[model samples]
Target: MLYINQQKSALQASTLADLAEQLALPTQGVALVLNRQLLPRALWAQTPLSTEQDHHIEIFQLVAGG
Candidate 1:
């Protein structure tokens, strides 16, 4: 079980990258955080997310407008 932005989700993954893919979210122009910690893009593929673990994950997207 995982709580993304305080919303309950049942998705499990071995890495942050995998979790993003499973959620079908755009990897570009976005950022991921775990437990109030900033997650780097380069580390996403190695960062861990497990079914047995409960975490507070947040994704922030950058929007550009002029």
Candidate 2:
């Protein structure tokens, strides 16, 4: 199982892009971090996610403020 935003998740994803799709993440104004490292958007499609190990993925959405 992997953790998304500190919550445990059983969802299986082959790549970062897959995860984003599963979560219905927006194409813009979002950031993803894997194992404490910032993941570039360009690499999401190729980045592989393993189900055998415990991984932590953090997703942050940019919010507009006044």
Candidate 3:
């Protein structure tokens, strides 16, 4: 349940969805990597995040241009 939100280091999270919901982001563009292994975004909903797990999240934002 330890998650790094953007700039900050580590924080406690109840669940991965909770973190995504807090950020108002869909699980699609966000990538989860635990202990240096990349986790597929498709598994976000099913992935069980715990306090014992060390996770790194990468969120991607899309920009529109003319």
Best by TM-score: 2
Candidate 3 per-residue lDDT, tens place, 41-66, comes to 56556666676646666555544668
Those runs of model 1 whose alpha carbons end farther than 4 Å from true positions after fitting are: 64-66
Kindly list the per-residue Cα lDDT of model 2 for residues 1-66, writing each as its tens digit: 789999999899999999999999999989999999888888999999977788899999878999
* Best of the candidates, lDDT: 2
Selected candidate, larger TM-score, 1 vs 2: 2
TM-score of each model, paired residue for residue:
0.82, 0.88, 0.50
Clashing residue pairs in candidate 2, if any? Answer: none
Q: Identify the runs in model 3 with alpha carbons over 4 angstroms from their true place.
A: 1-6, 9-11, 26-41, 62-66
Which lDDT values do the candidates have, in the order given? 0.85, 0.92, 0.59
The candidates, ranked best first by TM-score, are: 2, 1, 3
What's the lDDT for candidate 3? 0.59
CA RMSD per model (angstroms):
1.8, 1.6, 4.0
